[model samples]
Target: MRLILESKFQSLLLNWYSKNARILPWRSKPSLYKTVVSEFMLQQTQVKTMLPYFERWMRLFPSFEALSEANESNVLTAWAGLGYYARAKCLHECARGFVKNPVNSYRQWLNCKGIGDYTAAAIASIAFDEAVAVVDGNVIRVLCRLLSITESFKTKEVALKIIRPIANQFLSKTNPGKYNEALMELGAIVCTKQKPRCEVCPVKSCCKSYQKDTVHLCPHFFQVKRTCCTMQRYWIRDTHAFLLEPSTVGKVFRNTLQGLLELPIMTPQRMSVVGLGKLIFTGKRSIGPKDFIEQIYSPQKQVNSQSLMSLPEFSNCVRVPFDQRQRLACTGPHKRWISKLLQ
Candidate 1:
């Protein structure tokens, strides 16, 4: 990478970004707190989907001090609708850590709970004006096309050794914050994955993949087959309240959903003994590489809720009355299910 080319790329990118950058809420008045919250919420979530949640979160938590002082349950509740609950937990942890011992550098931020290399770089550069490059999915795609590198980014070594070095080389030292954002913005709106807007791309002449006409094939990726899964949940209700339980899905859910409630899961053994009851709600949800067919059931016979309470399964459950459902912190899916059931 020559200094002249780097300078040209930076000049082009910064100019394009200044004219076309999306007016995100955090971009208007960026602070360390806003940057951290937005980065955490944007992980594995699209800008459109996360916008509402981000606004709501800012109202609820406001600042690092507010978020750190909030209870774990409140934090989880505020983050309910967004799946990947782990990110919420990590953000909460980061807030607590920041409140305890504030950090300004990428290296220092990396020591926090969920601040990975990319997140640390983004926060440090965007909020603190550090001369570091951020290599998110969009940036990776842009880099691959710009340089015509066909190495699979699925491989960790390729991303770190090949992709990251190029990203660093292209980083604008004079104004790294704007430059990094410009590169990411370019990848997002113009250098898209499916059909890149090569004609209108600011740096199209400098892009090797465009010059070679290998734009689509430059960034190679391994395809992953998604698995299908079926799960059952019970919606047992008494006159006053509905019976719910803590999530028992897996270690990740248990950790993220520590203080939240969810509909009771119907395991194979439990289904065998208690039956699936009457199917009320059937829906499809996707999480990561797994597609889940979720079914909600009620008891076949009108068994008294109190009588079922004697059962060992109900011992660990909590009853949420219709009036108080709004106050309780339920999982995102379960919250929707319960709302539909009531309607």
Candidate 2:
């Protein structure tokens, strides 16, 4: 029964794919290096956004040897504003690994730094044309809806058990690259997570969830609520410039900003103005009144005497009332610090 269902799905998907697959630069001239890089960039990122970055990255790196030889700072700089600095770090590590000792086998490639199951499978099948399954979020969504699978994939063991075989069965021996890409495209365009276009879906006839008119429900969507935290920051200004500091917290811009700056972060429980002043001024000894600038308050609140005593770093305090600091705490650790020194 599984074999029959999978065969039908493969036929429909591959047929539709041959006609409608997106013409991407990576696809025009697929290579092990290019495919690997594309897959890495594509994870949790959109195709349109990745296009320019991908082109620039390829131009700079060109090949595994070139990427391996490039400086880490240059790579990180190139990846700036892309977010997910770790991916850049991992990509560099993987390139270095490949350059050090090249291997022909996909299995051997998997053992390289930063190569996980999805990445390994994608590179192996798309670049090498090996008959290996590529299972990612798209593939998972497509499979679950087509098969009407209700089991929660929250568990790694259960997800692998359900998806591995399906991927293996549908993997095209003749053109695994096209097959893998076609599956991803079907999920991206036709079998979308929200409001799937079932009528246009080539595999609709084979999709049990589509037949039942419950394609969206089959995947069991989960939502996470984000909590917002409040923080207070001070832009200490001197005659020449404001002080900035490297954030100690592991966040988006950690090691980047320069200068000796201090900002008071306001928590839910408001600290007394005096406490705030002490917190800001106690640590520093170099800054003086001549170096200070007129305090600029957010919302332009008039500074009272109480607020003035709270700050120890400066004779005067500027109150800047930002709307609110909302952060996705679970996303990662963040170190909030003064980013620039303005005179």
Highest-scoring model, TM-score: 1
Tell me the tens digit of each residue's lDDT in model 2 across 110-169: 887666777888887777777888887778888888878776565544676678787787
Query: Each prediction's Cα RMSD?
Result: 2.3, 10.3
lDDT of 1 by residue, 8-35 (tens): 8889999989999999989998888988
Winning candidate number (lDDT): 1
Error of 2 at 158 (Å): 4.7
The C-alpha TM-scores of every prediction are 0.91, 0.70
Q: Distance (Å) between predicted and true CA of 157, model 1?
A: 6.6
Q: List the residue pairs that clash in candidate 1.
A: none
Q: Which segments of candidate 2 are over 4 A away from where they belong?
A: 155-161, 221-228, 231-247, 251-343
